[model samples]
Target chain A: MSKYYSKEVMDRFMSPKYFGEMKDADAVGLVGNPRCGDEMEVYIKVREGKVESASFRTLGCAAAIATSDVVCEMITGKSLEEAVSITEKEMVDKLKDLPHVKVHCASLALEGVKEAVKKYEGK
Target chain B: MKKIYLDHAATTPVKESVIEEMQPFFSERFGNPSSVHRFGQEAVMAIDKARKKVAHFLGAKEREVGFTSSATEANNLSVLGAAGGGHVVTSSIEHSAVLNPCKMSSGSVTQVPVSSEGVLRVEDVLKEIRSDTTLVSVMYVNNEIGTVQPIAEIGKAIGEINKKRKKKILFHTDAVQAANYLSCDVSELSVDLLTLSGHKIYGPKGVGALYIREGVTVSPVMYGASHERGLHPGTENVPAIVGMGKAVEEIDFRKGEEVKRLRDKVIDEITSSISGVTLNGSREKRIPNNVNLAFEGVEGESLLISLDSEGIAVSTGSACASHSLSPSHVLLAIGLSDRMAHGSLRISLGNETTEEEVDHLISKLPPIIKRLREISGR
Candidate 1:
């Protein structure tokens, strides 16, 4: 594990449980720009107004990948409103703590979740 | 888990022979060269011997060499010292040591662009020369992409241009990356000033040398007791200097051919086996030890991490690994998109590299890249 990343971050990044595309995802949230070098897509499957499954595809650094994985895990089994309300602070705390410069990675993951939820509500 | 170091361009472990030469200076021979005592005289003789070795390595006179803390300081003494209050011309792909100093210069700086292969065009550099331009600083080899620039051609062209001009435009090359494999003869390259680092060439760190051609006048950047001909003023790092000199003397370019074969094997194996992989820089003009590549749809930091887990040390040019979160400026200047720049990896070989180590890297890379591409859903 790199000293630059917390153990929790490295663990999730190395073996992210919720990484990949969900072809049948009811709604998807895409956040970040490729130009910025961190692009994330969050996929959600909805069941009875709650998240049945969540997955993510991230093209970014270790912190960004870890945050995406944690966010996906956080939204699973949670109601759409609860998932949307999951804060960047909560996500960062779950990963122990990201490097100060990489705190924005949590925010990017949060924005992905919000976008996914917003898409599901609109549909 | 076998550990393999492939980040030699960043630094190399000091050679055992260099350490053996440096051991006495740290204790038994510890004396300030500036002092007038008997011990000081001994230190002076040691320094003179090391200076002579360094001078011989660069094909320069003994007096032309000046010791600095590192190549960065030597570069600063060359740029900030010679081009103060005067316009400067430099390349866009120089290491931060040269680029940052040019930025800090009081004079205006014109950065000439490079080809997509990361090779700087001599004509483009000459086109940027202005009447007020006093210095043209370029690197002998790019640290990131490993592209070797045409230093001799640039120097000769600048020399010809200086013949008809009133104020001679001084030519300088940061040869830190080239010292291990390329010739740095000051006259052959026709450079007025040059920079070299100790750690980059399997020598101890905290020591560097600059070769200032005879008749060149460079002002001191730092103010202190008159040392290094008043160009750089600081207590000499005697042990590191001795090690650096020994390292320079030990350099044998013949060894580079075998390293080049290994580098080519890595490149050929990776590129042929992996799809969507592109090599950066001019392969023919690149240094023997460097292999920089960009993996499509995969983030470089993730690849670096995965490789690190397997005990293989490498580096990336991705923005994620940088303090400023900016992708490598060299890759960008070479016409790579931001996404591609974020996927660049640099693997540098060293004298100790072997076929088994190369095979280990080759065997490990495909799966790691495939896994990253899968995670990114590309």
Candidate 2:
């Protein structure tokens, strides 16, 4: 029903994929917005120059939460460099659409993941 | 799963009786209340009846209540009109409707902070009052945390505080959230002006009233026609006013026993059923309908979306300001980290909500938290 995400994304949000974290993450990034009260912590497990696993703990709106779940699915098998390049537009496209109000939440999740990957690279 | 509505604190659906009562005003009694003909007389009679109904509801004299576009407008008028370039004192947690307007006006407000549990400190309010304080505007109930301010105590304080000062400081309350759950009588609350809205009480939107104590003068916010005694000026939305009155005319608040039973069931379920959770509002003093809880590991926004997928409709607080990137000011004021603020979910119950729906929510929420937490691996 929302314009920002697809039924597929909403379905993933409801019955999310790639949930749970690696027992030992190579690196973790915690980012928060003190103003709006939204926060996300992402964990990355790198192996053989690829992102073998991805997990997130998010304190945000539904869009941010569901988007994180979707991001995990999208990044799990990609190279660290590739995963870091993920965009909110890509997530929004995957969702088919999101409302204007929810777009920021999607962007936050993408940024949170990228920041986590950057943490892994010491950037 | 079938959907259930619980967020009545945000806004409620228009009742059928109110809808029926409003029909004639739109079609038949469409004349402006200011006209001087039979058509105008009919419209005038209707508005008078609606005004008297609103006044009677508040147990004030018939001429005291002035109709406005919404409770927000009434609050603006009361806060602005009463303080003519003089000082104002109000709560830090007032609905942005009151707080923002108060901030923009010529007068300044003290904005006394509430306790973490959201109780207004009576002493802090007293401390804020001074010789230059021309008006004291406090809300009867808080919208975000569902904390009820001691308006009666504040009223007593204002009464005593004003007796010593020569300015005759007026006392006003944004009583929009309190009308359904609390008493409507202004005398019992001991205030000079009170603001109320219809949509919050199952009436149509865009119609509200300000109960100004007789002989308590205030400058008009909108200037034009003599409608609403020049205090408010506009071609009245006759239908919405009728609907508002009808909504008040019928009082069907869910009972204390029922409210407690359902409130406790949901609180027990959310607190016990789900992990990584913390209730944001003060449980002891909160409105029975509101349940704002924070999940530590998972973001409230993400949880909100996941739950939405299960056909649930809830919110973090007021639906109006939910979209902003910043966390809730009220949450921040209570000492929550950005993490705690983002993880909050506000579940407000309604008349139609049943035990089964609550059980369904209880069943659905834990898995989402568990799944989200796992994804984070923290």
Candidate 3:
């Protein structure tokens, strides 16, 4: 296990529960850039005003992948408003904490989710 | 779960023979070489013998070899000591050990660009030399891509230029990586100074050597007693010095060919099996032990971590893994796009690398790349 990541982060990275593209995703939000070494696309399937399913695909380090996984898990089965309101701190807490250098990963995950939600509401 | 080390460019394990040779120096023969007594003389004689051995390995004279704490120091002495604030000419991809000193020097520096394959052209270096330029330092092999620089050709070109110039330009090469696979004969290469590291060559860390050709003047980087001819003034690391000498003597080019076979096998298999994998650096001019590859639509740190979990060690040029959060400068210098640079991995083999280890790596790599590409939604 890498000292750069928490055990929870490593676990999520190795076996991401919500990894892959959602074929039926109602809204998709992409954030970060490959050039910056972390790019994430968040997929959300909504039913009646609640997130029916959520998934993500990330190109990044272990922390970024884990953060994306945790963000998807956090928003699933939640109202669209609640999902968009998820804070970076809450996601970081879910991953047990990130290396100082990797804290930006949490921000990227949050941005991805917000972008997806905005796309859903606009439509 | 056997752990495999493929980061030879970072450092190598000290050979047992080198350890055995260093054993006596740490305790029984621990006297200071600078002291005047039987004990000191014993240490002195051992140092002399080690110096001669290292000098012989480099095809240089005993008096030309001066031991430093590490190759970084040796490089500092070469760039800062020789140039002494005069203009310096160097390449874009030199190790920071050489690059940083050149920047810190009072003299203006001209960093010549390299070919996209990471090979420095002799004329590019020759064209950068100014009337005030006193030193030109280039590495014999790039640590990242393992591209072999044309040190001999560049050295000869500089030598010809020196014949016409009033003040001759001194040439230097950091042979730390090339020492294992290439000829380091100073005269044959026509370099006025050279740098080498012990730890990179299966010897203990904390000992490196700088070769200064006769009549070439270099000032001391530090001040202390008249140790190392006052060029590097400090108490010598006797044991590491002895180990470095033993390691240098044990270098065999025949073993390098076997390593080349294994390296080729890994490259051929990975590139053939994986569709988006691209080899970095010049295929023909690269060293035997290096294999740098870039995988499309995948982050290198993720691949490195996945391999690490499988008991295999590797390195990446990804910004996520770097301290400065930027992709490898060497990769960028070679004209790789930022995305490509961030997706690159470096696997360096060593003397102990075997066919079994290579097979294990080959079997594990394709699946990992597939998984990462899938995760990235490729």
- The Cα local distance difference test for each model comes to 0.91, 0.78, 0.90
**Model 1 lDDT, residue A18, Cα:** 100
> Candidate 1: TM of chain A?
0.97
lDDT (10s digit) by residue, model 1, range B330-368: 999999999999888999999899999999999999998
Q: TM-score of predicted model 3?
A: 0.95
**What is model 2's DockQ versus the real complex?**
0.51
> Model 3, which residues run further than 4 Å from truth?
A47-50, A79-89, A121-123, B318-321
- Per-residue lDDT of B79-119 in model 2, one digit per residue for the tens? 77878768889887888888887888887678888888877
Q: What shift in Å separates residue A64 of candidate 2 from its native position after superposition?
A: 2.7
Which window of ten consecutive residues has the lowest lDDT sum in model 3 chain B?
B317-326
* Order of the predicted models by DockQ, top scorer first: 1, 3, 2
Candidate 3 CAPRI classification by DockQ? medium
| Model 1, global lDDT | 0.91
Judging by TM-score against the true structure, name the best candidate.
1
Q: In candidate 2 chain B, what residue range of length 10 has the lowest lDDT sum? A: B251-260
Report the candidate with higher lDDT, 2 versus 3: 3
Per-candidate DockQ values are 0.71, 0.51, 0.68
Question: What TM-score does candidate 1 get on C-alpha atoms?
Answer: 0.97
